[model samples]
Target: MAALSGLAVTGGTIAACTGKAKPQVQGKLLGPSFKAGHLLRKGINVVPTETEEQEVVIVGGGASGLAAARWLKKHSDKNILLLELENETGGNSAAGKNEQTAYPWGAHYLPLPNNSFTELLDFLQETNVITGYDAKGLPIYNEYYLCFDPEERLYINNYWQEGLVPRWGVPENDLQQIERFQQLTEELKQAKGIDGKYAFDIPVDHSSADAQYRDLDQLTMLEWLQQHELTSEYLHWYVDYACRDDFGSALAHTSAWAGIHYFASRKAEASNSEPHRILTWPEGNNWLVQRLRESCTDRIRTNAMVYRVGEQDGKVAVDYMDLRTQKYKRILAEQCIMATPQFVNQRLLSALPELLSTRNLQSFEYVPWLVANLTLKDVPHGKGLSLCWDNVIYGSKSLGYVYANHQQVALFPEKKTITFYHALADEAPAAARGKAYGSSYEDWKAVVLQELEKAHPGIQEQVEQLDVWVWGHGMIYPKPGFIWSEDRQQAGAPYQNKLYFAHTDLSGISVFEEAFYRGITAARQLLNTERA
Candidate 1:
């Protein structure tokens, strides 16, 4: 998920919408085929019914996998095959469309790239996100992709505010605290380490290793905030919200380094828009996912569930099932890129247990999430400022929703799609994940309705369809001491020059840029080894 920069504000009293009893909305409770993955829990014994060969095999078709395939296609001519478990290549970036409009199931936006990340900028340019560069060398973003006006608003104190950083009706003291926090973020944004590198880098791995900044990884974000004596209730809420928004972890659970990186790592400037503005589509990041898939589409095999990967003789062996045919396949390749997450890799690489240590894998933690897309019969009515791309309800456990069609030129349409996101960050991961996976559709419908009622009053009746998606292992969380730990480094290393690893989890934070970088890094490793 793309995380916006930090915010600050004033505390206030508010009232809740009391009228809605869960309206019987029509829709399906949809999720990943958990059965496909659960097969690994117990042993899946199968003999290969067919054999195949490839110069390189890329496993797991998420962002990292797709990117790895894209890079390999660009830099090398090895016969490559990309296997995806789902029918589509996008993982968290997957999207769906109904009669009303296109909508995202998970990650929805891409913040403008830092100028230093040339590769990311290049990809954006290739996809027409960065249409061109101005004489000053700043990127001129495509107007159509830039988040439209009325970018975001927050429902607070029973009133809607124009911006997310709550300033309306705030006391002078609260405003002072908010201003101080803003100043701190600005200073940190430019701060560099003694090693002549930014203290926080977007890909995260490129950050300076200077102890001055690395030491911050030892403490939680909340601890860091307390140490700096920046404890306004509003500031804390906003900080916590930002943490959960990006990291899927609470302020107390997120590493200070990771939290600070959230605000400081982005320094992207645009010729056509503000640096803070982000790019989005009706289908969210899925638009970019499709862009990445264009060149490598022919090489991708969907519904391929790879169960095992290991070194055999002098090559890599990958065993997978073609869900479409219910047949098994074994592919041998000169090199393999396991672009899957460590959680899945734990089982896939079990045949070669020596490749990973239990401790190293345990250091990686992921959080669960619940995303719902509701098609409303009419535009939602709310107090204050008009509807925007992103809307949040103050004090709600949910992260709120995004108007999927906000960018449409048509106004006040008969129907509109809005995607809601709720990170299970309020409790222990185990309990939250259990509830997410175990809860029935009715249970979640009630939850979704309750959160929406906070801002929309008795508007549940307007909901035509409410489809829910559960990301049980949504994304990696950057815990205290994990981001800069040696374990993280070890987990991402190449194995025997035959298998390479890539995933945002290896970076201790899940982001599009990180996933893209890891894929590029893994491909580069393989290409470099081939040359050697």
Candidate 2:
């Protein structure tokens, strides 16, 4: 069996290390309302006690679903209903709060947006994230929301480095390779194709169709690096880290286009702080989700598990289970937007799989993730560097942890929370997801501590509370040939002009911006159909 990264251990070694159990920690496991959705898999046969008619029904209250609801409410007075299986609306963007502070469950930050995204900027402006515009027409971001100084650091070579990219103790040759790769990415960032479109653009669908650059989509990021003779181990580690951080996949599994896109896609104009600095809060994206939820509060319904979606009597029928009532409910709508991931969509529309070809659904593969929020009385100070907002341990399978209170304005605090993230990119998606779902909190705690102890010896003693959340289908990985495939292009197609699909999966990259875009696009399509 292949040894895990950083640990350099076979499967047997892992068992040996974790065989001895320690004192139980003082926290519980929390996650999405999987039970509500899992009930559908057993086959829901309950008859609906109530039938309602809606102008539009949006399934899945993630970013896409919320965005669709907001757009529809703003454009038309038509009654719209948005349903979410989880108790909370913000899918992966969900957050939890304790007395000390609020921490993220999944997604944690949003980079500065390009001015081209007028709609997104408008939403930000409405939410007070973009306070005003400067003399140069640059967006003025609120200082409170911008990430604090001492933003990122990396633990490398038994010492904490100042930045995420390895600079300390790296050999001259490896350093040069890393610099050369940066130069290449910088050039690509400014590169434009013959059609006057960026070689790599966010929302990926807007990227240049010029085959000269689009052809790269057919190759793995690792293959692309090898072809460029940029094979430094340090560089490989850095690139793989970026892939895992953004797409939750390694270089070998990620598409070259998506890999390059991660670095070059952002072309945000110079802002009040920095050109492309990220904006984040203690609650992560849930802060944004709250603003979106406020726009259409009456239209949103949580704890509603959608089981089947089919067309009947010239309208789409959305059958869902009301978890509170333990009974089925039905919504007949003129138009429907499925904001759920393709995996869930496949099952919901299983009876109508021909509409969304099963072959297209097979093309998408989701990566699993483990996020743990450790409440600590005080974190053990590492050797050379203090706690930064984002701290990454070099060569570890787990991406270290983020200081959740890094953005807090309070001058003094006795307690703190650190959110740790790990992407199981080395294993097959299905196998990793199954193993993660089957494991208990103790099993995960062992895995997390084993990785953290490498950077912080005896750190577990400082932990007061450790809450773990597993994302069975965290996000889609843009594997080679999958990004530009015909199936992906057809995945977003509306069925009979009555059913529209909107989800980050349709964009081939899972990001807040992509999900928002898909939702708004689907909503606009519905409006246009109504007008026609």
Candidate 3:
């Protein structure tokens, strides 16, 4: 196989190898291949047959799988099958709609893309989100998608304040510490390792492996902050909010490397706005997912839960159960891309030949989240900052909420809707999920209303309808050593140059950038094999 050297593969002559259709073989017995057969025998029934062929079978129809499918279709003429467990393709980026407006269920926001994120930028351009470039060659993002004015407000000391960082009624010393921290992060953004990799980069894999920087992965963010004498309660709260907002983990639970990366990894230079600006739609990331879905709608199969995967007779076979039909179907493919999370993939590939032990794969943990969308007659305004795109409360366990109607600049008269997103920061995700699931709709509504009532008393009266969603395993939490661990690195590597893994889990931190990069990486690997 030819070595894959570039980010994009434009065109290729790849074709599926033709073969006669084989009858469905059902049994628990191992196939001809001893290793693969033995591995299948240990797992649940429904192993792959040796005599079947498919061009490619992609598991999970999330951003990663969709990205891979887009790349495969654009680059080569190969038969590809994309399987998704849900009825939708967006995964956590899924959206919900009411009579008033559409809202996000899980992931609701995305930061602006850095210039180094060429693939992402190109995709945005293709989608018309990047309308054109300025004279200086920076991207001028679409005005409609760029987050509107009055971006964020935080409720603190019984007053709503402008911006996320605590500025109102804060001690001068703590303010100085916050300034120092931002300045240091700015320096780190420009810093480069001896190996020429950025000290901090999106997708994280692009970061420099230099020991000077990699050593940071060994310590917790809390430890690093304390070591730097940044012990102010306000400063700590802000940092913890940022961590939970993106990584779904608190400062003490996150790695110093991941924490600093959140601040320094952003190097986005745009023609219209500063590097810190972000692009968002009313429905959040669902807008981007719609663009991805446009690439290969015909090939995607939703509600197709993949159960088993294995290689047999130099080909890969994926056995899946159709949730709607309750029928089992097997897809024979030359290659397979597992874009599901590590935990789900572990179940599917448990039957695969020479697969890793389950114990090793179980080391990773995911955090849960509760997102509530409320239709309101009006949002009670406080004295200081007005309702904005992001509304947060200072010193609160919850990450406040976002107003979905904010992007619809055209003002409405009677009613407005706001989605309150709560990241369960303190408790274990499993416990939180259990609590959330056991609770009724009214109970969940009470939970959300109570949290809101803390900041806005009697605000529940303005609410017309409240809907709640619980993501049991919302995102992978980057514990101290997870990102730089050898185990995670090995798990992400392709198996036998045919089975590739792509997911936010592989990146050890779940973000849109990581999911996009994961898909591109897996697609590039498969393209290389075809070229070879």
Candidate 4:
């Protein structure tokens, strides 16, 4: 165990007198002196105590964890505890602030919500994103935080253009295909099963399980596109980009069901806002995380790395190491929520006495991501529209980046910063993670700078600092038949009434909406169990 290193005091240090020389010590001293053998005590832990237990134990404090915590607290009277491996609660939704602007390390944006997503809209309303409902019950979104003008720009053929869809210099045949594809999506949006469930829905579980649609999940997006005669290169490129941006995989690897669902799932409308307008902040999803943390901070323990979970005396026992203390501790709860990704859950469940076979879990593949936040004096201007919410360079493997300061209407004259986001979707996650782990800070910086130099010449001179964040298992890809497989469904299902699963991976499409809804579903299920 690591030795504790500081003294605890209720007030300040006291003053000592020697030969008319005064040494002042202030405040009320509570504990022992610190000179080497002292045990460090902080917060509410100054008094040593035994292990604690709660009714519900939630692991992983990222967006999903925090969301689960919030929902559980709101709906239950039972004692609850949330354990986070990291010191902070946001997880991948974490954000940082430089001297210039606040930037996101991972997820940076959320598209507009469909009207059917009442729960998410309610949360937004509580957060003031939706100020009020109009006379006709239409939600009025906050004007300030709605994504600013010039939403997206693409650089192709050395010319900066507007919008992400390939329009500039697009061939006539490709344009027609793009239109046809949009028409097909519109048709799917209205599709329903014999059970009356939408063919595609927000919380994917709510979708129609009709074999006609479910069978689509068995095929790759590439195959479906080819079968539909959507063979335009421009159309194919746009589809690929959409899949990579949201699912973190290419069309060839994504499921036909997930790919089509991405387009058809959105059925949003607002009185004051456009259906396509999204609510975003300078810190991205971290903004939502702050709200989620408000109701559960007292119940959360950070930097607690859980290693094992199993049944003990008819209760769920969680064994975790306190990173700060370097000591292992155990907590027993009635139920557990495994809010981590499938990969991490596999390791934890492996230690259980009656471990479920992991054959199905192993099929899910996660992709890695590299996000670079650059502090710059100024961004070089391009030929067309100025910096937008989502910017990209056509044909570039990178997702380009967003101007972190774009949402901040209060403009500064000089010394601006921009976050350059590059998702290395081409490399397998295992290879990417290995390479990213071995890369030095300088090496990662070079990779980001080189990519930026393509769009902005002499950008190196303007850049004051560059920070790189690598996500080893950023998101689970819908990989070909994986989405529609029996394995995925089984992996996501609750096990033995003791363990529950929740993550974006269960939806077969990793996105903010899916992650949010996943947490809600798990929490609701747990609540229902307790009620019964």
RMSD (Å) per prediction: 4.5, 2.6, 13.8, 12.4
Residue-by-residue lDDT tens digits, candidate 3, 417-478: 78777666566656654554455554455556667867886675577777777676788978
Residue pairs in clash, model 1: none
lDDT of 4 by residue, 370-439 (tens): 7777777788887887878787877766678888888887766367666666555666667665665555
Q: Tens-digit lDDT track for model 1 on 441-499?
A: 76676677767877887667788898999998997988898888888989988988999
Give candidate 3's error at residue 261 in angstroms. 0.8
* Ranking of predictions according to lDDT: 2, 1, 3, 4
Q: Residue-wise lDDT of candidate 2 within 1-532, one digit each (tens)?
A: 2232233332233345546534446877777767765776677766577888998899989998899889988989878889989887998999999889999998899999878889999999999999999898889999999999889989999888888999989999999999999999999988999999989887788788889888999999999999999999999999999999999998898999999999999999856777658999998999988889998888888888899998778889899888887778888898899999888877889768678654468778999888999988787777777888999998876778888899988756789899999888888888777777877776677677777777886666677888899988999979988888888878888788898989999988888999899999999988888898
Q: Quickly count the clashes in candidate 2.
A: 0
TM per candidate: 0.95, 0.95, 0.89, 0.88
Per-residue lDDT, model 2, residue 427, is: 82
TM-score of 3: 0.89
Q: Which scores greater on lDDT, model 2 or model 3? A: 2
lDDT of 4 at 474: 76
How high is the lDDT of residue 2 in model 1? 14
Off-target runs (Cα >4 Å) in candidate 3 are 1-53
lDDT of 1 at 397: 59
Against the true structure, candidate 1 reaches a TM-score of 0.95
